[model samples]
Target: MNRAVIVAAKRTPIGKVGGILKDFEPDMLASFVIESLLHETKVSKEEINDVILGNVVGPGGNIARLAALTAGLPYHVPGVTVDRQCGSGLEAVNLAARLVQAGAGDIYLAGGVESTSRAPWKVEKPTSLYREAPHIFTRARFSTEEIGDPEMGEAAENVAEKYNISKDKQDLYSLKSHQKAVKAMESGRYLEELVPVHLLTRTGEKMVIAEDECPRKNTTIEKLSKLKPVFRENGTVTAGNACPINDGAALVLIMSERKCRELGLVPKLCFIDSAAAGVDPNFLGIGPVPAVTKLLNRTGLSMIDIDLVEFNEAFASQVLASLQLLNIPEEKVNVSGGALALGHPYGASGAVLVTRLMIEMKQKKARYGLATLGIGGGLGLASLFERIEE
Candidate 1:
């Protein structure tokens, strides 16, 4: 297998649903990122072997193709889209790494994009008796009735109950997430990976959005604890502890070592290993345990070797439980905060994590970094990256 290296990774500021980015299409947002990457890296679009994107709730078309064309890339560049729900973005990166390893391609552009605001209402099959517009939120995209899929929040509730995680602990974690995020935002630690973009308003107004839109400056544990449980009456998960629906896009330029040398491009991070795992749908939040453990075992490395970890904050309960199962110190995970504070743009968050992790690794001069996310329907995805230069 050929070694794959990441040349650059970047993401748009995650916008809350109905926020600054509500009007932008996911494909258009992705194209903007693609164009920014090409211009920043000076990499010719023709050199790209493929453009693979991870997307969900975008009207179910070829998002990659749309993004590529919108970015004005040559028509010959093959484009592919992968849908793994929340893990789609990182899955796309993993697929690109594997492609390089398998000698299938030398250079690839991969990432994820999502626009919850633009998600259309779906319709179910018509019936003689009655028919109404299907609720996309109610529909289980991952499994059918026989498979018994549960909503993400409901799964988080199951995790909290199964692991005996307390409401206090969940609220505490949620508070930490916001505090870290606010601190990072104030210090501008997130600036390195952010790509400023213009957002259009309903009344023909334009705003330049440059930072994540979900962090609350006045977040406190007390405030978090006071919020009522949203998933269930007695559930530990609350709106304050859960990731907000969001809009955003993220991408990375992946290339083989030889390709990097050929193009005179510096390798920022080396893709070392990745793994995906599954768990029961009810406890889907625990999916990261097997996925991350498998990756560490295969790499013969310990969580101790990882200087930073980006575990998606799908919910405070889910992340807290996964951290407990992995026995990793809280300080080592999401040091700059997570989805709880930044918002979850679903399909785009995985790649956003990778982009954030790599940037932090450089700033902290870390040796190894890991990015991982748990998906809907019992799936977990993880990837390990090493700093290749500086």
Candidate 2:
């Protein structure tokens, strides 16, 4: 058996739907970060044994393989794509770790990419005898009809009502998320991990997209309160509190300890444990609690031992409810911000959140950190990272 460690992590600045990254393919976005990691770590292309990417919606021909070809990796480096909705990215990393731990591979590249702007409108094929319009929906079904696959916003609402979380509390958490993200951006915290994206405009102009386009500098609780609920009439969930449709990509290099030493790459974080759990589809937001509990149990650690946490803020109510149920402090989680402030790009968000924890944990010299997120259909994924003590 072997151990896996994180040697590199990087992401493109998240773009709002129909925004800066709209023209880029999800495969291209993924390749950009993977190439950046290879360059940053000075790792040879031949050293990469596999490329695994997580993606939610797009043209579905194994985007990871497309990325590998686009990035000019050799033919021997194959790619695999996984879809666990929002948990896909972290789950890719988790699977990579397992492979390394089982002595299957020495080096691997795993992460996620999403191009909401480019996701094609999927319409079911119409029979010649059938009626006029085809139902166009890009997202795939969550589960069997008996299990139920409620819309994500509806699940957030269920989480809020089921846990008795109030609208005011949700708004408060949203405000703080914006505040923290704004502060982190102003302080250049994201620059360390951001890979600047370059775009050539239609009119022969060069455009540079460097910062996340979602966080609002003027966001306030008052403004959020004035917004109408989106999921249900009189519901606590609102456009301002839930994640926006976003486009982005992120990648991390995980290598066995032997491979790290062989390449002279300094590992920043080591994999401690990872787990997944599921719940009733309606209350999907609470999924993380059980996933984290399982992860903690595996690591034989407590919340007190976790110096930082990144709970994807799919909805403010969802995050708040989970924190309350788990007895975790808000201050300990998403210290720099979360999906609410940064925009959630579905599959890419999990890896992006993990990158956030890695940077913060290293800066704070924290002992342990947990990165976790709930999926759209009752699933949650959690991964524990231990800072490499210098």
Candidate 3:
């Protein structure tokens, strides 16, 4: 297969649930990032062959197609929408690389977007089982098996319990995440990848949301310890340790080496390998362990060979568990902070993490970087990128 390389990657500043981007729709947010990418790279609209978008919640229209048109891309360009929960963004990138490697497309845009502020509140219709079995009022059998999807918070709590992770340990990890994120921000490490988004306020005032608004600047172990668990009464997964709802979008341009040379574009990172694994749905948060192992084995590289790692911080416990299971060094993981500090815009998280990883590797002059994430419904996805030196 021919090699595929990333020519450019960019992301809008992650906004908190009620922050500057709260009013923007997911498609609109995606369009903004895509437009910025085209302008920065000076790539013409007609050059793009395909646009792949990742979205977790919204109307079920063809978001990628709509986003492409919304961003002023040529109407002739085809688009596809993908959904792999939190891994959607990264999966889109992986798919785009495959297309280029197969010589199916010369240029592609892959990314994800989420607008939690506009997330639709799903209301399920009452099923026959629920209506007929009114007497079965227990929590375990309240609804039909097919209709009873547990919330992420409950799934995280289950993972914590199964792994025997303590609440104090999670709290401590969360505190470290915030501290590291604050340090990264204070040093302006994220400035390179984060595009400043000018948004309108509630009263039509313009404002720029440049910095991440989720990381608790004053977060401490003591402060986190006082918060109650949101999933279970005695659960370890608390609001302080879990990724918050967020709004953002991230995009990456992938093309074959020949195509980049033809366009006089510098290839930044070469795609190495990507893998996705499935596990028990109840332990969904720990899905990354097997996925990363498979990816490393396939590439004939050990965890130590990876110079940088961006494992989406879905929760402190899940992240800690995945690291311990993979025998990955903590120091090599999320050096610039993660979702806990930045924000986790579910559909856009995977691509966002990969973009951050690329920027971090470039800044540190690293050789290899790993971008991985645990997705909802017991799935894990990972991709390896090698810095392309001139």
Candidate 4:
């Protein structure tokens, strides 16, 4: 029984799909963060017990190992990759903490990475003899056909309809998300934890991407109201309310509390506990309700006990529905914006939430922070962290 704590966290600026980060491969993006984390923490590669990462749609190899080697870590260090879809990154960090608590590792690097622009197009072998061509799949199935599977956007629409979340409310919430994110960016709230990404363009010029590409400083509700629904006919879900496909990577340095003391490093946040839950695929966006409930029950805490919440805003409708059901005030969630404004880089988004939660809890001088997100295929993952009193 050892305690696990997060001593450092860093992430690259999120880029819109086929935008600033499109040139970098998924492994390259991950390697940059790995190198930056090692440099920032001044931790030797030999001390790393393992490197774990979550990846959604990369070339089907163990990317954690690939990125670790690419970052020039010693060959002796091992790496493993996990895939829980959108929750992959947060789950990776949770796994690291559990390993630390079990006395299995002293120091670990865990997080997630995703490059929608670079993800390979998956093609399944043709099952019928009549069709020899391989069939393409945009994503993996969350459940079997018997249980019902819906597109992420369609699922959000279902939640909105079932929960009576209005289109106007969703648009208003989305507008505020953009406003808050723009404010945070302008005030340099995101600068300290962001790692600048360096790129070499096809024109042979060097470029450095240091700012997030998703936040819009001039977004307006009038503009949002004019947009048409994208998921269902007369549906409330729209591109304006849903997170855009994005590219980025985030990583955290986790170590046992004793190891932090030995290294003379003060941890910013202590890993309290984690929980996960499954729900009906049709209302996939409501996944966070049960997961957060389970977490509260396990920790003997309530929503009022949390000072800050970083719930992934996959869609304004889904976020609104889940928060309302959980009795979490809208003002306490995503105070500096969320995936709606920052963009959602699939596997990397969960780790990004945790990264924001840690930094924000420190800035606000808060005690408890919760990072949670609804998965694509009816799953939700939540992690609770307590800020260390300095």
Candidate 5:
């Protein structure tokens, strides 16, 4: 049996939709982090067994292979792309670890990338032969019509209503997220894991995007309280309480424990285990509860045994509901804020959580860290990690 360990992780600064990263291609964004990881770990591309990446909305092609080639890896290094909606990135890492355990490969580069601004327009084929035009499809169907697939915002409303999470609570949680993110940014805590993207202006001037662009330093509960619901007229979920569309890429270098030791590479976090679960699509926000519960139970651990948690903040209501159901304190999760303030780049958010968790664990000198998130279509995924002692 082999253990998978992460030796290096890096991510591009998240950009708001139509923001600084809009002009960059998804493959290029992913390549930047891939190149950075290789440089930081001093690893050769020839040693990589595979490249895996998660992507949601982009041009219809294999982005992992495109990114690997863009990053200048050899032709022999094959790449594959995975799509599990918001859980895609976490699943990619999980697959990489499983491959290592299966003795299929020793080294793997795995993560995710998303560029909402550049996502191509999609259309569904006409249902009838007589129909001449295709209908625009904003998102892919996650469930059959019979099963009832609500928009993510509507699902958040369902979770809030079912779990008694109020509008005021959601607003307050979002405010705290912004506050914590502002504090972290001010202290330069995020710089350690960030890889700057250098861009050229139209005038040939150079520009460097090195910091996240979405955190509001002066966010207030008053402002959040004033915002109306986006999905329903009387719903609690609002733009203020939900994550913004964003663009970014994140990657981590994973290698077998034996190979990591052989290369004299220091392991940051040892991959312990991973779990996935599905729930009612209407209350999709509660997805993480069962997922995390199964993970802890299978590993013979509890919330008390975990030191830190990174629950993707797709919506404040969902986050609060899931935390309450799991009996996990809010203080133990997202110590430096989450997608509510940092922005969520869809497919890349899960990997971003892992990247942040590794850094937080090292700084806090914690032992166990968990990365978990509720995915689109009522799915939940979780991965557990243990920090390596220096």
Candidate 6:
């Protein structure tokens, strides 16, 4: 297989739901990031062979194709939209790498976008099984097992109970996440990859949302301790410890090493390996344990050799559990903070983390970085990148 290399990766500043970026639609937000990447890298739109987008909510549309068209790319450029829940963006990136490695495409764009503020409240439809047996639909609220369940928060609480993660530990981890995020923002370490998002205000005024809005700079452990659990009255997961609803878009340019050199583009990093794994749906948050272990074992590398790690913070308890199970060093993980502080934009989270990891690796002069995320449906995805010398 040909080595796939990342030429550039960038993301819009993550905005809280109903916050700075609420005015823009998901596709529009995704297009802005795609256009920014093209302009920043000076890469021609015609060079891209495909565009893959990940999205979790809203009416089904060819989001990838729409984003490319909106960004002024050729209509003929092939596009695909994928949904792996929180891992969608990373899955898109992984697919793009496979395409390049397989010699099917020389250049591709892969990423994800979500507008939780505008997420549609979809109504459950009668399942085929229900239709076949009309009496069943009347007897039960819904025919599908998928639709009759509780929200993700409840599922997270279930994981907490199963893993025996304590509420205090979760709160401590959540507090630490905010602290590290605030530190990173103060240090201006995220400026390289974060593109300022421009949007229209309610009064028809223009504004820019440049900084991550989820991180509570003033958050204290004492304040976190006082918060009540949201999913269950006595559950461990709380609003302060769980990922906030957010809006954002993120993308990366992937191409074969030979193709990048031919186009005179500097290779920022070469994709070394990628993997995905599955776990019990009820304990979806723990999916990353097996995923990262598989990737490390496949590549013959140990956790200590990894210079940087970006693990999505779905919930503080889940993040801590995954880290403990995987035996990852606490200091090296989420050096810029994870989704708990940065905001998880569902489909956009995986790509956002990948872009952030790349920027951190460049700044730290690190050789290797890993971007990983736990999905909502018992799935985990991970990608390994090796910094290429300029």
Instruction: State candidate 1's TM-score.
Output: 0.96
Q: Put down candidate 1 lDDT per residue, 204-237, tens digits, no spaces.
A: 8877889888999898887887999987997888
Q: Report the candidate with higher TM-score, 3 versus 5.
A: 5
Off by over 4 Å in 1: 129-137, 144-147, 200-206
Looking at candidate 5, the ten consecutive residues that score lowest on lDDT are: 124-133
lDDT for model 2, on a 0 to 1 scale?
A: 0.90
lDDT of 4: 0.93
Model 2, which residues run further than 4 Å from truth? 127-132
| Estimated TM-score for each candidate | 0.96, 0.98, 0.93, 0.98, 0.98, 0.92
Worst 10 residues of 6 by lDDT: 135-144
Question: lDDT at 108 for candidate 5?
Answer: 99
Backbone clash tally (model 4) = 0
Residue range 70-108, candidate 4, lDDT tens digits: 999999999999999999999999999999999999999
Quantify how close model 2 is to the true structure by its C-alpha RMSD in Å: 1.2
- Which candidate achieves the best lDDT against the true structure? 5
| Per-residue lDDT over 1-390 for candidate 6, one digit per residue giving the tens place of the 0 to 100 score | 899999999999888989888878888889988899999878788879999989887446878888888888987887899988889899999999988999999899998999988886654555675565333221112113663343577778887887788999999998898999999999998888888887677799888788988889899999999999998988989999999989999999999999899978898988888989988676778888889999999999988889999999989878888888988888888887888999999999999988988888888889989999877767788889999988
Residue pairs with clashing backbones, model 6: none
Quote model 4's TM-score: 0.98
Residue 255, candidate 1: alpha-carbon lDDT: 94
User: What lDDT tens digits, residue by residue, belong to model 2 across residues 1-390?
Assistant: 788999889999999999889999999999889889998999989978899889998689999999999999999999999999899999889888889999989899999999999998888887854676787875677766887778889889988998998888998898889999999999999998999998898999998889999999999888999999988998999998888899999988999988898888899899988999998877888889999999899889999888999899989888998888888988899999888899999889889988998899999999999999988778888999999976
User: Per-residue CA lDDT of candidate 5, range 43-70, in tens?
Assistant: 9899999999999998869999999999
lDDT of 2 at 111: 90
